[model samples]
Target chain A: MPLYLIGLGLTPDSISLKAINIIKNCSKVFLDAYTSILVSYEEMTKLMTEVLNRNDLIQADRTLVERDAGQILNPAKDSDVAFLVVGDALCATTHSDLYLRAVQEGIQVKVLHNASIINAVAGTGLEIYKFGRTISVPFFEEKWKPVSFITKTIENFQMGMHSLLLMDIKTKELDWKLYMRGIERYQNPRYMSCAVCCQQFVDVLNTDNDADLSVETKQDFEEIRIHAAKAGFSVDSKCVACMRVGTDDQKFIYCSIGEMAKLTEHMGAPLHSLVVLGNIVSDMEQEMLNLWKL
Target chain B: MPLYLIGLGLTPDSISLKAINIIKNCSKVFLDAYTSILVSYEEMTKLMTEVLNRNDLIQADRTLVERDAGQILNPAKDSDVAFLVVGDALCATTHSDLYLRAVQEGIQVKVLHNASIINAVAGTGLEIYKFGRTISVPFFEEKWKPVSFITKTIENFQMGMHSLLLMDIKTKELDWKLYMRGIERYQNPRYMSCAVCCQQFVDVLNTDNDADLSVETKQDFEEIRIHAAKAGFSVDSKCVACMRVGTDDQKFIYCSIGEMAKLTEHMGAPLHSLVVLGNIVSDMEQEMLNLWKL
Candidate 1:
């Protein structure tokens, strides 16, 4: 099997004409749904439908993926397979595993890289190398909650760097009928929302001695800019709220956490992530971030 | 005037067709040259020629961006300005100031996000968020040598995390020619190659106790998987040498730093960066990271 691992970056519109071309040319596809999900699920589906003119492309969720990537590995052993990954083909190492598995199975594997949030955060005006550590703000468990991510964020800011806070995922696509990693009934109905993310952030600061290194106050939240980006690569429903990103309708701005807390109206759908910007007032590229406003 | 910020990830061709369409629509560009540089001088120029069909886009080296941006704010305020930034648009907060300045001048700004090595490192089989304070390795100098970045890397790994070792860029573009920061030029015009990056890692470790953390031995060198991510963005050229990343291009193997140090031939062009993999390998992903033909 000649399997091609293709990536679909941040937003639905983020994919290139080239990727669309490759998808069309592939014989068959096996989309991995575990490592990451597309920014625009429906939009990407629509796009693939339009491009492939077929809807039979296999949507390989975690179970199928974790179990038998061998199908992708030895596709031509029966049929040729084109493995599709969300975001970039290699952004998450799991896709590489699938590729290697295919190679081990003597399946001819190829990779087609696309834009992922790994590089998309550049839009937030933060230096990629300067970013301390990236931590996802997953939906917390009530009692056994883990918010150590806050400590990392504070550390990043103190070092004069920006932090990218990826929100968690919540979907209903699991095959509940199947018996697997005890995950048959493993549907967590909620994804991490910016509201939760901010509330937790403030909670962390309020509990610490971080006045100089904190935005603990509600007033400071007013100065915070929180952007919630959707997951699929074909999504246009991306909601850009928080005044800090721009004057009015600008591409990027620095909004206070308070403003971000009230952005539920702007943040719609799944696959949402946040960018909590700090001290970005010096980039000469700022002249470019806040554009397209009336 | 309006300014647009665009990121070109790590691959030379890692940009989106949408981004290219947007770039072509721009009249002039002011690129920020400090955070990261495009592929090589030749590739960057060629990219411009192929995309915009023009070569007049102003390469705003740090000095030019810092100084000339003022003009972009004032007299040239009426022109549609595009500030092409490397990596993701918001990955570096340094560019936000430029956006604010444009806003102050009543100009508009837009950001076109692209992939960067920040997330691309995930392709190396390391957990995206399991990384610690990111730092750069400068081309070693005779007297002004420094290796503080090593301290941070060690701290992160000690805490069970990874480290992204960025390579430095020494550019001499039109912007550099006109607005020189006059930093010392490299004696050998050498970039911090993988071998040098590893050697430096050894140099830093040697100063302290790396006996347990010691990867000084050639055997240790053989165990490391150094990534040489070349040609970022849409058409990125990636060759995972020490290991076969996702696919097998056996042509890229050996013990040049465990075959991870295939610097000269693999690093498609200049402006490439190397990431030293740490201990926190995602076991699920390691299945692939291990296949890296070491």
Candidate 2:
């Protein structure tokens, strides 16, 4: 009995024939639900169950994944177990830990790779090789405000490479408790939108720096262009929009960063990513960005 | 009529159900063959053709792709057309250009994402977010030796980010002609092996540098540890090996660069990638790499 770490890809149809074949053979199926949410979780689960003809699909939240991985591993020792993850299995560090844990426990492991947002961001017309280290923007708190992402973005800019900023998602139960007790009662899981992310970027640029900034660096921060996209399940539904930050016309309009921050129109659903462009390397990228120019 | 840029993931089974369904409906199908080669191209094409019940699948070499893309796009204007690519559809900049072309022509286009070597490299135990810009090591010739990859790898190391070095493949027909007339008759396709890449790196460090090198920088080039892997179609068949270059005992042995350059063992088939570790960010990565430690 081996443990299979399978990637569900981006959409219900994105699942590979091999992945479905493995799921149909597994005795226990568990879906990891904390790192990132699938575009349509219910629809994906329904499609999986229907295709596999198995109703024993279980959802493994952060608690079960981080603290009680043994619950999945113990069963894998005697039965074929499948742990399905959104995007690619190795996209999240936690899933890689699980793969290592299974190997350490002497339970054979297999990983089925699929599309992850890491590579899918190429859909934004940016060259994948031109991307630098990726950063995540966590929800800011009154006491804990991280500007490391800003520093990383500046480094990427200096290196002539784009920076990919992943928006925060509240999926862990413990984090929910922390939010519910302090703020309004826990509403549905919160996804950081492009509007909020834009606001956060502006706030960081305006408040975080204490050193003397060069005139060019100041202008870079003020007029930096951002490419924001809600890459939905498929290409047909994806939305890619770009805007510069400090200009006038602040609204839902795709104009400046100030404007995009105040936007109320929804890009789509959850899982939004922002790309702060560095030096536009190719003619095609420049041309593509021009289409979204305000 | 719409053009679909579909990805054939890592393995034959990595093809998605949606891709198969769409291929069944597509009136024309062309496979791009120059950028990267699939693990088992013949096996995959056979499986896809049989499953889709179609035999009109055309292999689009670099000439056809770069010079006669209209052969695919023109037909796409009047019928459903699919351009199948290895790895993720847009991972290669050329495919992205083709996509832009389709859009500019006002022909509807859809991209079906799949696993790319970019994401699949995560299986090497290096965190995806920590990887910096990717570099390619082309086969060196008398007049066209390129050592820019070495410079970029050093930059990534200084920035504390890992570097993914894509080994060059001679899939272009023009290059085949250039090599065939000069050297021995061109053999089947050549995939840069870890031994050859390690040797190439050593050669670059030894002869190609003119800048002043600090002791630490010199040591960095001398003792850089690289993770090499032949990621096969199945997880069980995948091989991940690590070695430190410049150390003694290099005969096809998983050791240091100085040793690896002279080795003769074949590290399996083509399409191999190398990862020069910058700074291991997590204990898990260290632990995982330990398994492959020489």
lDDT of 2 at A37: 57
Q: Write model 1 residue lDDT over A97-123, tens digit each, in one string.
A: 565567677776556555565555554
Error of 1 at B22 (Å): 2.2
Judge candidate 1 at residue B230 and give its lDDT: 17
> Candidate 2 chain A — worst ten consecutive residues by lDDT sum?
A243-252
Give the per-residue lDDT digits (tens) of candidate 2, residues A1-294.
Answer: 899877777776788888888888888888877643563457666787677766677888878987899999999999889988878778765466787788899998777778887887776667889989988888866545565676676677667788877887774334556566675354567888777876766664453562445555545444432211111111111123322111111111223455556664745455567776664457777665554544
Candidate 2 CAPRI assessment class: acceptable
Interface C-alpha RMSD per candidate, 1 decimal: 4.1, 4.6
lDDT of 1 at B145: 41
Write candidate 2's Cα lDDT for B1-294 as tens digits: 889888777776788888888888888888877643563447656887677766777888877877788998899988899888877888865376677788888887777778887887776677888889988888865445565786677677667787887877764334556566675354566768866877767655563552555555545544432211111111111123322111111111223455555554645555567777663456777666665544
Off by more than 4 A, model 2: A39-41, A172-185, A207-259, B39-41, B142-144, B173-187, B206-263
DockQ, each predicted model: 0.32, 0.38
Give me the candidate number with maximum lDDT: 2
